[model samples]
Target: MAEPLSSLSLWPIGNCQVSALIDDAAGLVWGCVPRVDGDPTFCALLGGERQDEGVWRLRLAGQVSATSQYRRNTPMLVTRLEAEDGSAVDVIDFCPRYQHSGRMYRPVAFIRIIRPVAGNPRLEMLLTPMHHYGTEAARTTRGTNHKRFLIGDHQLRLTTDAPIGYIDEGRSFRVEQDLHFFLGPDEPFTGNVAHSIRAMEEATELYWQSWVRGLATPMDWQEAVIRAAITLKLCQHEETGAIVAALTTSIPEAPHSERNWDYRYCWIRDAYYTVQALNRLGALDVLEKYLAYLRNIVDRAAGGHIQPLYSVMGFAELEESVAANLAGYRGMGPVRIGNAAWTQIQHDAYGQIVLPTVQGFFDQRLFRMADERDFESLESVGEVAWKMHDQPDAGLWEFRTRQLVHTYSAVMSWAACDRLGNVAERIGRPERASFWKDRAAKIRARIEAEAWSDEKQHFGAAFGHHHLDASLLQMVELRFIRADDPRFQSTFAAIEMALRRGEHMLRYDSEDDFGQPETAFNICTFWLIEALHMCGRSDEARGLFETMLAHRTASGLLSEDLDFESGELWGNFPQTYSLVGIINCAGLLSRSWDTVR
Candidate 1:
């Protein structure tokens, strides 16, 4: 079977509402319909004999070869396949997303425009949209120009310019003029489908290019930063501003490793880093939208309690279960649906929630600046951090079987109170500032006293164990400890000693529920890259960052995990965390703007 997730070289196109991963052959192999979290309408990415259930394939009757590329700087993908008879078809796949009306018209749709590129090409279209994780295919009925598919409570209409009989009967026909298909809601398509798609393509290209133009790129590594930034933006759900961790789930970290888990939900820690990275590029549009998402989350948590992750729609309950109907990535079993980590007590989220929102209180350029009430609402988060700083829960790792009083969690908790105090002072609330300042100081004292390992001369993963983790690098980021501090330096060296694998870095060297990790977590390598720069290893850091850049996919994307030994990407596709790493490292290590002259 194909390693559908990483193999076949999948390219993704999304409108922030729906996303699809297509194979180089122009097959709609992996995509969820209606929404990113919805049931798989194209589930062939995860292996199964059920290709007729959740996949769309466009092929020439005698097709022998294919190649793919994205349109210049835009997410539009073009795949050309040449048949043995010297005939070819170019498949253009994109999700229609441009400003429609006064608001963004990101309807749930996948648009494909196919054109004959060579002599007498014959095209065959197999659109098998499945429901309930590919357990069954939907019932289809047809009109003169459209086919309506009924899947559970949803109705999908596939409007096209081709002969309806040819599509319904799977008949191969001679290629003629341009053919367009729009698979979305069951409503009637208003105008000429082909003309509308052509217009949407032009508008979509303009939208992406214009968005790219606003990015504040560094003098060096301009292309890498742009691609990474664009991928990160695609992770955001435009309807609600919640950014997902990745577009996929169940892509294992290593071969047959059940480390395969769902990454379709929003993790507070991941979103904070994403915003921080985009904020450096002056993409306050993302940060500002995310701040609103953060505020919604905080408001929904009327009490002090909060989850480490939530659905893209901001729902809290995400019960995890194995999808028995489908095989996992590369035929790995037990593909998972919802993430269980949402219930884990990752205390670091408190800091992350406050960290991004605090920027709004100070940044004047934002249209909707945060006010006094926002700061007060944020204090409630600080109080939770103050209460939970020393308590034991799942660390950022989300260990399925164990819990520990993680040093990283305590420091982040301290950061929460620390930022709260800063925001309070900025808003002229001296008394509130004093209160949070005192709390932050006390939390810092506890972290300093308990998390330190005198024998090892470094901080540990937890209060007792001297095991070093790459997460400790955030000590400098959270400002809990200065980078030059001997303790932090020792910790950095210690983590590198244990977790560094040649040019790559692992989250840790220890065993978890799935046994020891065989692949380097891609984001951890970037953390090491940033740490090296801060520690005055600028040349080594630059060399390492460039090496990591070489590992990106053909489309200039990264996954959650990397097999350093083999130089193969693993885990979920187009991981936002990995993309954030690229943006952050490029910004940190780029040559000074003054030297550009």
Candidate 2:
């Protein structure tokens, strides 16, 4: 049995906490538990050193093959096996979530193990736990039985009443036959499969089914789109509403190109889109949780300014440190920890936060004068945007090389002012309304005058440069300009000519004279799809949408970028923003088609 490079071959069936994939030929079950940051516990995508942090592998014999699916909407995964010897086995896995009593909480994370019917098929199990992001080794000890190991400040307890056999390694263990593993901070690990496994299987089936039934999606792309949404929801930090950019880090931006970047932290820009997508799906509970996170950002910033990204726990000032000791995935050098884009004046971030905040107030009717807390949140965001209106920013791409007065940044700055004006008027805040409206108008005039290039007759990447950028696709998506506007057409043409790579597009080409061009960004491509829809190119837009969908991996996963020449995914696997953008863009394009038809 061998591992297939295609993700489509891996079956996906799990809840927000963990998604399990089964390899039929290998008879191996793989699962990913969303971490506080973006990385997964089982990182088979990264390979070698980045293979997996915590693993549970079971080997089945007798020429057995497997098939699996989720137990409804619950996190429970069920894999069925049939062997040549006419034996069958049902393997179920699930982590009991914090959702109960109509609320979700953290800690006491539970992973239930169940085997409904053992077909007397021989199976071998292996469990491994790596510490400090797979950088350090740990010690293992046992109290006469159960496999117990401690790493750093945490202890893992593996308990199974099954006839468990063990093979000892220095830091890990290889278990045989029927056994179970549990990991946590303090709880003594225990699992009695004989009785508990059956109960767990039934309970898990009911849980997921109930969850799926509660969803209110419009039912257009229910299967693939909802699955993508569920995957994004799972990537969220349960303790905090902060969502990560992806579940794995250091999967090179280009194959062997030294372009890998850590995408674990919460990006303010990503959160804005996430709110829109979730709100449209009627997932108000999740939306409000994220709004609470946003309010926390405003309270902490206090008009000083907010970082573009933050830790899962809302910690700002992400230090871009590297883990020098650990061997990187497939020898990709200098694995990064924190993001340096936090402090830069990516002025587009201002609009990212403000636009969604305004949308919340308007669309959801979330703000009221009587609610002091809501007013405070709006005021905090408005005041910050007003203060930073004139400052230079790094722009939408968050270019690592230099800071420039990016045209996209100006567009967002103007948007922030525009949204504040609208929200203030709605809430009868005259003072704020008048000031923001005037500010927005002035910013708009300046953007048209300064960001445009007379020589090229198109929008420039920044205030002075001649280069174009796909970020301007947002100009139409955000309603900054109408689809029929001649200026938009010219700008779109320039961007298509310059940034488009094959069927996809990029943020902007580098300012330098040297080095090869990188792959087209996945998010920007969707931005183009939306722009096309708005421009009255519905047919073209739908064609592009299908083209983009074709790029999805075998398991319906997308990366941050794609190699233009080779058609291989570059950057992290299953990028959250990319998938979310696809869903949103597809929805918009479909609606446009319906309207035109």
Candidate 3:
């Protein structure tokens, strides 16, 4: 039987195409195939209490304990499982992704290399894949050296050097030699299994290390920044250049809160933050590809409407549904599939699109520079931003119950017009620059007049309300207000008073659609840290950042939320937003290289 779906202590391995979540015991608990938003082939992560199937586990007979870590700068995970007799086995897991032919060759494949490192080890291989969101097991057939799993027009073939019969029947066998397993598309692997996999591993390691070598990492917390950067890269679907919010869906924000929602789709707001953080690290490849995705989205919008989220393939309309078959994370139930928020009105998206697009106009290292035609396309999005600057929508938190002119949304709209003005000036269009700058000024004036609350001496969550939220801290980051401005300082102080919970910070203290959030939003906490630094509280910001770093999982990554009191990670696995926070905070707080040099 597979182990029960336990904690969020999971490690992610991917190739920018597909990803998997491996538990501490080296079990492949959750993985979606073909793409990040596809079916959950390994769905044991949500298989309720005591998952019996839908997992791929290399079990060591008489296993005592297991420990796992990443391979330095890459997503290649190395897990060491020790038996009671001191015999141990090292399980190396990775998805094959490296440069090949004349282009990048990232296939939908997973590779596992098992080697005995200590005394004689006994191994049991259990490969069970589920179909249709864990409703049924994938029917299997076997050959002499490979096993094929059939799932509704799609097939996955497992080519291995281990005894096929042993794996098919789930029997324990003594491991006297190394074994390699390649589970990928339903096609023949063209060479010697052992030699080809080893070469792929070496090439993949080289690819990631070389990529890391090019990063402009911070002087301190370099490892944490690198890990977070790699995790963000994994969340991106390179085929379309769209980045998902998180790898898995239905991992509740707070346990039993029924607040679970699918995060596998691309959010314009999230991707903007992602590109911004990655751009800080000098990772332009991701920025270039993501800009391509944004252009497509802008072109499709045709200067009018824009959604908050879209499928990784640029498709709209994600009808949210529940997976009745799977029990949920830790048996919490109501495993959701698609996101309903894609249909909601999130006016902040216009600014998100413009914020990242503006970078393309000025950056010289990019292969393709933004031209007049690109600016014209961006103007359409800017028009929407102007139209919706004061309009009510779902806001950034996606409140399902009410609609209001959120301060964050209006500020983002202002940022859109503001950046367009900058882009226009960069492209030598003084007339257009003046037009956008005027609109931005008008929006800024309105925000300053209405969003401030004299009663509470802080900016409200919405235009006329006095409720405080952590997103108000974005005023400095978005350039809406000077950090030293008295109003912003007062706003920051008021937000800290209401939302600060010990070392963590909440998105808000009041009730929302979910009856008050039960945990601290990870990215919100990072926003507070950034706000503290900007407010001239450098020491306090550094201390809080250290506390947040200490709360990351053993894999040096965070999810969407963290329990304030217990410090346990909750929400979806490998959240791009939380990972972006790590990179951004590290870059902001790290000492200058001159000091170290």
Reference-based lDDT, residue 169, model 1:
92
Q: What is the lDDT of candidate 2?
A: 0.63
Write one digit per residue (lDDT tens) for candidate 3, span 389-432: 99999899999989999999999999999999999999999999
Which numbered prediction scores highest in TM-score against the true structure?
A: 3
Give the TM-score (vs. native) of candidate 3: 0.99
Clashing pairs in 2: 7-554, 7-555, 8-554, 8-555, 73-208, 74-208
Model number with the top lDDT: 3
lDDT: the better of candidates 2 and 3: 3
Error of 3 at 156 (Å): 0.7
Q: Report the candidate with higher lDDT, 1 versus 2.
A: 1
Residue clash pairs of candidate 1: none
Q: What local lDDT does model 2 show for residue 402?
A: 70
lDDT per residue (tens digit) for residues 486-591 in model 2: 8888988888888887778887776432246578888888888887777778788888888878887654657788777777777765678787876787578554
- Each model's TM-score, in the order given? 0.97, 0.85, 0.99
What are the lDDT figures for the candidates, one per model?
0.87, 0.63, 0.92
The order by descending TM-score is 3, 1, 2
